[model samples]
Target: IGVGTCIMILSLLVEAYGGYLLTHPPFSVPYYYVLIVTEESLEMIGTSCVVGGILYAMRRVSKERLKFS
Candidate 1:
């Protein structure tokens, strides 16, 4: 649970950074690639975390049920 929450927070941070990069391009290089990559990575991370959390919770519930029987 804690790890999932942490991942979500990190994803939010990445998204914010990506938005900033889009608005304010870097001096040396254009930030379009950086922004796109960051956005996609954040989305992937968020989705993975959500799916992983759901799987973990389901497994925990199944284990508890088996223990009762």
Candidate 2:
């Protein structure tokens, strides 16, 4: 969980950096590549989060038969 949180923070930072590069000057080749990769990473993060949420909901719903007393 801690590592996932760290990755989430880094992902947001990358997104912001990419946004800044897109709006500013000096749009070099390296920056363009960074922006592309970061964008892909952000998409993957979003997809994973949605999938995780769905799986969590399914797990909770399926656990109705469990008696943990």
Candidate 3:
């Protein structure tokens, strides 16, 4: 969960940088497009991690309850 949150924050920063670059780009147009792609990819990966973490926690809790029963 913490890892996912960090990634999400990082992606947000990347997106903000991209927005800033729109007016003051240091590189070519293609580079900005690439940055956009990277930002989107990061967001997807972060979401997956959060979901995976939730599933793992749920499984662990279920296993503990089963043992008690």
- Estimated TM-score for each candidate: 0.57, 0.55, 0.87
Give the number of the best model, judged by lDDT.
Answer: 3
RMSD of each: 3.0, 3.9, 1.8
lDDT of 1 by residue, 1-69 (tens): 556567667767877876676677553245656656766776677778778889999999999889953
Q: Quote the positional error of residue 20 for candidate 3 in Å.
A: 0.5
- Collision count for each candidate, in order: 0, 0, 0
Give candidate 1's error at residue 38 in angstroms.
0.3
**Residue 44 error, candidate 2, Å:** 0.7
lDDT for each residue of candidate 3 in 1-69, tens digit (9 for 90 to 100): 889989999999999989888878476899889999999999999999999999999999999889953
**Which rank order by TM-score, best down to worst?**
3, 1, 2
What's the lDDT for candidate 3?
A: 0.91
Native-referenced Cα lDDT, model 2: 0.73
Q: Candidate 1: give the clashing pairs.
A: none
Give the number of the best model, judged by TM-score. 3
Deviation (Å) of 27 in candidate 2: 2.5
Model 1 per-residue lDDT at 15:
72
Q: How well is each residue in 1-69 modelled by candidate 2, as lDDT tens digits? A: 344455667777777887788788877878678777986786677667767777887888889767577
Give each model's whole-structure lDDT: 0.71, 0.73, 0.91
